[model samples]
Target: MKIVAVFNYLLSFLIAYWNTESVAEDEFIYGQFPSYFRWGIGTSSYQVEGAWNLDGKGENIWDNFTHSTPSPIKDGSTGDFACDSYHKYEEDSKLVKSIGVDFYRFSISWSRILPLGTKEKVNQAGIDYYNNLINSLIHHEITPVISIHHWDLPMPLQNKGGWTNEEMIEHFGDFARILYANFGDRVKQWFTFNEAWVICVMGYGDGIFAPGVKEITETPYTCIHTILKAHAQAYRIYDLEFRDEQQGQVGITIDSGWLEPSDPNKLEDIEASERALQFKFGMFASPIVFGKYPDIVRKSVDERSKQEGRSTSRLPSFDKYWTDYIKGSYDFIGLNHYSSYLVTSASSDPGPGWYGDQNAVTFQDPSWPETGSTWLRPVPWGFRKVLNWIKNTFNNPPLIVTENGYSDLPDVGLNDYGRIEYYKGYINNLLKAVIIDGCNVRGYSAWSLMDNFEWASGYTERFGLHWVNFTDPSRERIPKESVKYLRKVFLSNGFPKPTLPWNSIQLNEQCAAVALDPDTSF
Candidate 1:
């Protein structure tokens, strides 16, 4: 089988790498993760939930984007019937329990809850759907980790300028307040927004995502400023009004990646790497950790804006009120990291928008193995590097790794040996960060539970531990070897005792024998 061979190759590589690397003397014992370390799986509403127009759910920007005359989605597919999870969450909950995860991290659909994106109109059907999901998870003793916004902004808000409009602060706060009032008692961990960088940079700066507007110029900066304020308001509301009563923790999830300088000895390359980081992670994180934009970002954007004939600095400034409110607002740092980039100082403009705005360029090493997705390349060591960077830069903030996974096209079948290697290397590096480097990571959630609509990629790419047959009207779910692999990791609470060369072909055959069945409840 193709999968068996891939597994063997991956194990051989890992064993060789482990033998050569200089490990710390005081490294935490393998497979001895702390008792409280949480393991979970992640999914987003727009990407997974179908019934897009059913149950009075208001149209979100994604709905509009996918339905546009000239759709940008690669496969010309829309998420209108994605997994039908909106109608079959009971089945989803069971899938989570079967995997032995401690929690399920899923986002709330803003348009589903508030059709008008305002408190004046609450959709009872949307409320009912989520309530049923929460109750089911609770019944199974699986904790619910909620993300308040995950890019499915109500079309009404998009029509009115979305994140770019400062008025969004009140809209988001009110929407968050509604969620807290209803579900705060049961849901203890809350993510105010999922991947602020993707929402701003991909959505506004690059025009590749929903409500597509390519303003690689200053709009992304403005969008993130408003988003940060909105996040602060939601966090503060939960902090002041609900934390004592409900005992829940609130924070935001950021999409950050490790950046390796193209030339370690060159100052220009090192600075370029830092600039890339500042433009992405620091754009949102600085407002939370330092209560302002990074100096590099401010300086670069200001200088570039002036040169481009702008009247003032492109980077927006927060008042003392907002700065104070945004600072120190998180209970934990929720990070969603996937691949790392090799960065170098740009000799010329990289492109329009954020690419050019950063004054740097990123490329991937040809030697690194690629996943099904063109963007994802496995570089496990970078995972530890980024984690250490977070530990030092943010003073060892408590962290929940919200998303990480590999993608392969659906035609690959459910063998998914590549995904197994991806998780193993990244998770092993994560353990090194926590144990040897002393980074304060408390949890890890693989990017998704099953393959669903992958945003712009549509149904072309699969990231789920379990594979879903999109062409099947029943939306059948099938277990991949990664599921069995991860379930073992969950049961062990860390790396398995022998550390995974699982060296025997018989062991690979045993893993390959796991069968797939349709979830009955769906």
Candidate 2:
């Protein structure tokens, strides 16, 4: 037995060394992406369009959240004058065109179109503003990908319980009809909602985002249920009413971190890692793909509710009609992935919240490359793994990476090498997933064209390829090193062949070593 164990150890060491050496000496050469593969950059309305309450636009949850007396924003700043994109959209479109991208992804603020969050009144000026933006992108030969709702719920709707109330399904459906009727002619790609997990869990459960409400036990689940139905409603409307004429595709964008087991050899840790993904990604994806929540999620939430002495589960049950309505309601899946986490089985019950229900604990690895955002670490391998997970889970549905970027502190000047390296590693892995692993990924969009309001964190974190001088009244835009890198990748459609092999292999080695180390606790 001892001789066999020695042989296994030596063999594993040799394999690891061989892999590391091959990666170190390999040249960064990858085949061109598919001819139809798209590259783009994105920004949200509230983040870029700063005309808060201007030109008939109504107050949104974000406006209320940031303008509160005791501001929830880390920098005590609001999006009142974000990037002034509402007025300077032409210039923004020019910036996007200069990047040599195929498309530009932006969101529509519900409050901007419907001042009261209903069809009873429509803001013509708001409609004209978006019309000009869309026209500008088209004039520059850039396709427009629009997200209908990006967490900027109209305040009037929040007063009526926002996403937690079932009425939101109809309200959102009505809103979608207005959008399709007005803008569907030009916008070919539509996302019904951006990051449903963040909208429901962070906004309602953790109370850290807009419309902050901390009813941890039930509010999050209720909000998620309503959002899913609302998404389905919008998709059905587009499919039934506008598909033939508009020729548009509608979907939802979900943001989730890849969860890696702390100890691959431990069954509990492995199970906990998968449970975390099912709770996070599967919670939203499964309903649209498989017509129901993951069995583990259903069972765990039901069991927890019972243990908490509740007669019913906090998770709302979908009826047969609604289940069928939501099933296969999408033309594609938009994923907004940024980082990853290491998950382990919790030692004790975490109480009656979402985290407690999963019976799992997640944390970041200190050895991983860090970024300006504490929650985000550049883990490129995680991106590949998550892509594979989605392909396997959903039977390889058409996938688009709606948002992926690296954040930096405000002081990281124009020569930002870190951001360049970050993109290089992530995009290289992205190519590997598509070319080598055969994941059905069709497109990718960088997070922001320029830094704007970053929600609760405000302007403290910058995730833009172009630097926006927030202090200047004009908000001067200057391209960074990362911009040139992305432009090259966009122009070539993939990494170009190098004249010499690259030797800096720390990031790849760290990811591989950590993944293979069974005893290394995350």
Candidate 3:
């Protein structure tokens, strides 16, 4: 077994090396993106804004989480001073303007605005801060795309059961109304929620995130149920009350990874791959697009509950009213895609949890290039495939790539050749999806504008085009090599004729070495 593995590894490396050399020599000419297509970069409130509790801002789940004894953050770091964007909006706006992007996508801190997550006690300071930011972006000719919630639930609300409680739908709706009334005039693109799955599954099921609760059977499902309802409520609020006047679009951003079958020839593997996607992406998307959960999700959870001797299904069911209300609630779909996974059918029941319910096991292929983030791999082709899947599944709803970018280790410095290649491959694939595949992708936003607090991982993972000096009080931002590469891509609107050789030598060497190591985890 060892001898065969070594030989296979060597053969794979040689093949990859030959392909890399050939591609570097070939003249690569890419087609132009649509002139109407927009470009932007993104950052969330908790990840970028450092003033966790200041100037009438209340505590959020993240503030509480990081402040807890023996913090769960990998580096024992908190976002209390994360990039200090709260105090440096002017500087940040200048950075965004320098990027030459058409827009900037950012999330409003729920507690910052409402202070207590309610509309009753509005935070004037918070309102002023965002107003200034918006006015600054507009001053710089940059549109502001706002996400109402980005997983930073006010601690006051989390104490009241957060997303697991049905009352959150009303609270979230009220929050949306306040935002629309205040910022909707200037903010034309509003995302009600960012990455509902991560907010629910990772936060509630795995307990690896803030407001942690690890009850997999019902907690995660209940949270997502509330989230979908809250999203719909926010969408409806904007549609009925503010749409005519504000002239803004409302959407929800859902993060999904492309899943491929481990064995193309095996029916079970293919079925498992589809089931995994349905469980992961469709769990949130289906509610808004198809008016209910995916058929497989419903059936699987129903069957699993029965096996557990429960009289009722663990998965929450939406009645006719919700089915109709949630359907067609979005003006567009906000998609955040990063990586791909190979999935196969679990040989046996994997027990009672989210992964168990799907009956699928997902893993990464050794040949795929890795990133500093353990779960992410550079699989550009998967981007196109996932876009096509969305196009087919949702009947080609107008879509925006909300969050897609590469991450590197903290010490990788500013050169960052890997990130440049990543953008090159992924953006090229994105072009193919829009041009050749005919997917209705409207715009794209890189995951971040600068390095800041990365949730549970703290500052260990850097996913920014601009390197931020975390140690400095000012958090000075320096552009990485990828920034220059992306600026050229943005200025040209697409990849122009390659005047220089494609820089794949380093990436090829790294991936080839990774492929040879059988024990590599990520």
How many steric clashes does model 1 contain?
1
List model 2 lDDT by residue over 1-522, tens digit each: 546534543443343333333332223435668888999999999998898989999999999999998999999999999999998999999999998899999999999999999999999999999999999999999999999999999999999999989999999999999989999899989999999889888999999998999878889999999999999999999998999999989999998888887886666776787789889999999999999998778989998899889999999999999999999999999999998899899999878878889999999999988789999999887787788777766788999999998898547877777777777677877787787667789999998899899999999999988889898989888988777667877887876443334355864554443222322221
For candidate 1, lDDT tens digit of each residue in 1-522? Answer: 546534543443343334325564223234457888999999999998998999899999999999997889999999999998987899999999988899999999999999999999999999999999999999998999999999999999999999999999999999999999999989999999998888888999888999898887778888989999999999999988999999999989988888877886676776687778878877888889889997777877877878888888878888899999999989898989999999999999764357787889899998989788888899887777777666655677899999999998447788887887777678877887777667799999998899999999998889998889899988988888788778877767875444235667765443333211111100
The runs of at least 3 residues in candidate 1 whose Cα sits more than 4 Å from the true structure, single-residue gaps closed, are 1-29, 350-352, 496-522
- lDDT comparing candidate 3 with the true structure: 0.86
> RMSD (Cα, Å) of candidate 2?
7.3
lDDT of 3 by residue, 180-252 (tens): 9999888999999999888888999999998888888788999999999999999999999999998889999
In order, candidate lDDTs are 0.84, 0.86, 0.86
Clashing pairs in 2: none
Off by over 4 Å in 2: 1-29, 498-522
Off by over 4 Å in 3: 1-29, 498-522
Per-candidate TM-score against the hidden true structure: 0.90, 0.91, 0.90
